[model samples]
Target: MFEVEVKYRVPNHDAIRDRLKALNAKFLEHTEETDIYLNSPLRDFAKTDEALRVRVYGDGTVVLTYKGPRIGNVGKTREELSVTANDLDSLLEILRRLDFREVAKVVKRRDIYNYENFTIYLDTVEDLGSFVEVETMVNDKELINRATDEVLQFGDKLGLKREWIEKRTYLELVLERGNERR
Candidate 1:
């Protein structure tokens, strides 16, 4: 499946949550997430624009996700594959033994909501500021264009301006900030 998403760096998160509430969006869950990104032994993920990470959710569920290179220009469209893992430590140990090195750890508190076809996230990361993401899953590759359009329109309805759109992931932003401190 593919994860088509659009993200924005917003100044006010409470306002967005109020908007979602006004729209009668279904409140999903509010949880904290920690994502540990790992680097591949064969190639540079930073240059390839790919990511592999293990996300540990607040409720103790762990997920392993692989995000392929993004497609198109309007939104972040990518081939995403994820699976739930029974043992987080074992999985991490396996990756480590395979020579995958830890790159960065991203910690965030997220409020998730669902409206129509979109799943929205209001996140506050540890080093990065507030962000809002609207995403949907599609099984067919041909549906990505239509899905991207709908995501952009949905974001617009939520008062997200074009200038507020952000392309960098939380991990990228955190790593960049660390670099600038040097």
Candidate 2:
């Protein structure tokens, strides 16, 4: 399945939260996430526009995810595959044994909301500040474009400006920030 998403850098998260509340969005869990990104030894994922990461949630559940390249210009629509891992350390060890090297870590607090078919995230990254992401999952390739449009439109309903859309991934943003400090 493809995960269609639209993300924006918003200055006020409380405003977005209020908007969600007014819209009667179902409040999901608020949790902290620690994402550990890995690079394949065989190829440069950065160049290929692919991503591999292990996400550890606040309650200690681990999820390993693989995100393919973006599908279209409308939003961050990509083929995402994920699995829950029972053992976090073993999972990392297995990846290491297979030659995957850890590259970066992104820590964030996330408030999740469900509105109709969309899942929204109000995220505050440790170094990157506040943002809102709207997403939906689609199984058919033909539905990708439509899903992307819907995701963007939902973001619009939440009062996000088109110009505020951020295309860069959190890994890229974090790495860029690290470079700037060097």
Best by TM-score: 2
Off by over 4 Å in 1: none
What TM-score should be assigned to candidate 1?
A: 0.97
lDDT of 2 by residue, 1-182 (tens): 98889889999698898999999999989999999999999999999999999999999999999999888986788998899998999999999999999999999999999999999999999999999999999899999888888888888889999999999999999999999999
Global lDDT of each candidate = 0.93, 0.93
User: What residue pairs clash in candidate 2, if any at all?
Assistant: none
lDDT of 1 by residue, 53-149 (tens): 9999998999999999988887789898899998999999999999999999999999999999899999998878899999998999999999999
lDDT of 1: 0.93
Error of 1 at 175 (Å): 1.2
TM-score, per-candidate, Cα-based: 0.97, 0.97
Clashing pairs in 1: none
Q: What is the lDDT of residue 178 in candidate 2?
A: 93
